[model samples]
Target: MVEDPLALWKALRNRYNHQRTVILPRARYEWTHLRIQDFKSVAEYNSALFRITSQMKLYGDTITEEDILEKTFSTFHASNVLLQQQYRAQGFTEYNQLISVILVAEQNNELLMKNHQS
Candidate 1:
């Protein structure tokens, strides 16, 4: 066990860098194929995004937020055309803002359905 936190972090980062060199190609391919419309709900999509981003950051070296968003948006499936249009039309420059819009839309849709049910 390393007594120094910084040293431990450095050691872990070095190990990750070694693994990343071997694994990044497969990881990048998988990320490219991941599409927003493949998920049935915002929550599911968000969870998958979180998982991918966290793994990429931890083992695939540091990626910029813009790069992540670009990779994510690159895979937007046909079913998400409307959402894609919204994104383009609104010109959202940040990834988090796009996530917020999707989540809020999901919540609104759920509330509308519940209201109709009542």
Candidate 2:
């Protein structure tokens, strides 16, 4: 949906910020009761941190906007596929709601980036 690479990069960065600031903390808190040694708990934390690092690296000082956009889009697509599989297997009813939320968040991010560019 994002035709401009630079704009897409900015939008992705904003989306990452929103997730880190809003979603990750709440998820972490809700799952904190689980034992740290549990595979699920460790995997969840690692996955979240991996995503954060990947997003940060994409926008890091040395990376070009074009590279960031390409890499971010590739990663996003892969992640979405994996998420879809997981949702289908474990959270069928919640899958659509989650996807809808993600789409709206991405659209909001794009709008914010466009406003900033203007």
Largest lDDT belongs to which candidate? 1
Q: How many steric clashes between backbone atoms does each model show?
A: 0, 0
* Model 1 C-alpha lDDT per residue in residues 32-110, reported as the tens digit of each score: 6777778888778778777766767777457677876775666678776777777768877788888888789889999
Question: For model 1, what is the error of residue 59's alpha carbon versus the real structure, in angstroms, after optimal superposition?
Answer: 2.7
TM-score of each: 0.66, 0.25
lDDT of 2 by residue, 2-118 (tens): 999999999999877665566545544533332222323323533553444354444442434444223323333453676445534553243235445545655687899999999
Those runs of model 2 whose alpha carbons end farther than 4 Å from true positions after fitting are 35-118
Model 2 residue 54 distance off true place after TM-score fit, in angstroms: 13
lDDT of each: 0.75, 0.48
Clashing pairs in 1: none
Which residue pairs of candidate 2 clash?
none
Candidate number achieving the greatest TM-score relative to the actual structure: 1
Compared with the true structure, model 2 gives a TM-score of 0.25
